[model samples]
Target chain A: DVKVTQSSRYLVKRTGEKVFLECVQDMDHENMFWYRQDPGLGLRLIYFSYDVKMKEKGDIPEGYSVSREKKERFSLILESASTNQTSMYLCASSPSKSTEAFFGQGTRLTVV
Target chain B: DQQVKQNSPSLSVQEGRISILNCDYTNSMFDYFLWYKKYPAEGPTFLISISSIKDKNEDGRFTVFLNKSAKHLSLHIVPSQPGDSAVYFCAAIGNTGFQKLVFGTGTRLLVSP
Candidate 1:
């Protein structure tokens, strides 16, 4: 079975603070993604990495950045955390061009 | 605009009955469709999938049917059990290789005994 683990399950940060969410996958998948899920808005992609050091902006990449220094780890960074940035962040990984994606438990971030 | 839509926000079904969840997509370029079930406080799990090349795919009691002409897909769960209750999300990926998926808002399913 594939396992995707996140660094934190819940986090709280003050406004204007920097935040980092980490994800690691044991499947050695080539594609990893970051998504923020909101009620009524669904899961919107924030960023994705196809390979080490290669990243692409998804539909909603603003206020967020990602790092993929290694194949097994992906990190999402918030330059300046704001109240509006509070959301349930999910990390997923899949084989290149494959439809099956395994997701982590998700991190619920709260910005106050 | 929302490319994928799950019109029904919630559905109720009795145990041992069939629960059908529907999803629609506006993008005709999407060739792959997938259904995911998510329990509260947990990440969504891959339930089943159907490629455009096939009209129907079945896995045990869960089956997915696709209608290319209408760009509609449905997930049917037979003999619904309490464990089947969860939020079902329909997702699609375009023909573009390694493209990101467009997900529906999701439908909450409740199974009663």
Candidate 2:
């Protein structure tokens, strides 16, 4: 079965603290993405990696950064957690030739 | 500006009724469109997709229609059930040779039994 796994399901962090969210995929997909879903904002892309060590900014990448050191693993970093950053973070992966992307279960992060 | 837009914020429907969700896009470079279903606290799942070459694509219970001229697409759910209640997102991918997706603000669907 194709699976995208997130390191944490929920996390609560203090303001100004640095946060890291990890994601891994079993499928050998070349493209990985990070997105945050809000009530009315839907899923806004934060960062995406097309290949190892290759990263690009999405629609929103102000306070977020991403790392793709390996083929299957991608990480999202928050420089300083804030209350507005509290939202459901989703990780998705897709093959370079395919448009269908598979997503992880998601991590609900709360910044206090 | 949002490349893709789902103007409706919410929709309610009775069980066994048909539910239609609309989406519009402004970018003409988008050659593929997709619909994703999301539940509270869970990640959005791929529901259906349509290519620019075709106007319609159908799965078991979901059908997606694309209108290239209008830069619009829609998802139709037949006999919607309570289980179908969730947030529906419309997404698009340009012909940029990569799978970078652009999504619109979602439409919350409520199917009451």
Candidate 3:
């Protein structure tokens, strides 16, 4: 079975603090993604990496950045945490474009 | 704008009834579509999927129907159990270089026993 693991399941950070959320996939998938879930807004993509050192901005990439220095790991960074950035963050990895992606247990973030 | 849209925010059904969740997409380029189920404080899990070339795909009690002309799709769950209650999100991929999944504002389904 494929496993996508998030570094933390829950996080609390103060406003203006830099936050990092890490994810690792054991399947060595080539594509990795970061998304934030908010009520009534659904899962908005923050960023995605197709390969090591390659990144693309998604629909909601503002206030967020991502890193993919290796094949199995992807990281999401909040430039400066804000109250509005509090939400559930999810990471996913897919081996190919036409296949289903496996998701990690989300990390619930609270910014105060 | 939301490329994928789930108009119904919530739906309720009895245990033995059929639960239908609808989704529509505005992007004609999308060729692959998927449904995901998510519980509270959990990540979304892939449920079922349908390609544009096929009109219907079934896996046990869960069936996905796609209407390419209408740019619409629906998931039908028969004999829904309480365990099936969860937020259902519809996602689409256009195969534009890399797969960038566009998701709809999920529909929360509640199955009563």
Tens digit of lDDT per residue, candidate 2, span B1-113? Answer: 88999999999999999999999999999999999999987888999999999999999989999999999999999989999999999999999888888999999999999
Instruction: Report the Cα RMSD per candidate.
Output: 0.9, 0.9, 0.8
Query: Compared to the true structure, candidate 3 yields what TM-score?
Result: 0.98
Q: Model 1, stretches more than 4 Å misplaced?
A: none
Q: lDDT of each prediction vs. the true structure?
A: 0.94, 0.95, 0.94
Q: What is the lDDT of residue B65 in candidate 1?
A: 98
Please list all clashing residue pairs in model 3, or write none if there are none: none
lDDT of 1 by residue, B34-78 (tens): 999998778889999999999999999999999999999999999
Give TM per candidate. Answer: 0.98, 0.98, 0.98
DockQ of each: 0.76, 0.85, 0.78
For model 3, residues A13-62, the per-residue Cα lDDT tens digits are 99999999999999979999999999999999999989999999998899
Question: How high is the DockQ of candidate 2?
Answer: 0.85
Top DockQ: which candidate number?
2
List where candidate 2 sits over 4 angstroms from the true fold: none
Q: Provide the lDDT at B51 for model 3.
A: 86
Candidate 3 docking DockQ: 0.78
Candidate scoring better on lDDT of 1 and 2: 2
Q: Please identify model 3 stretches exceeding 4 Å from their true place.
A: none
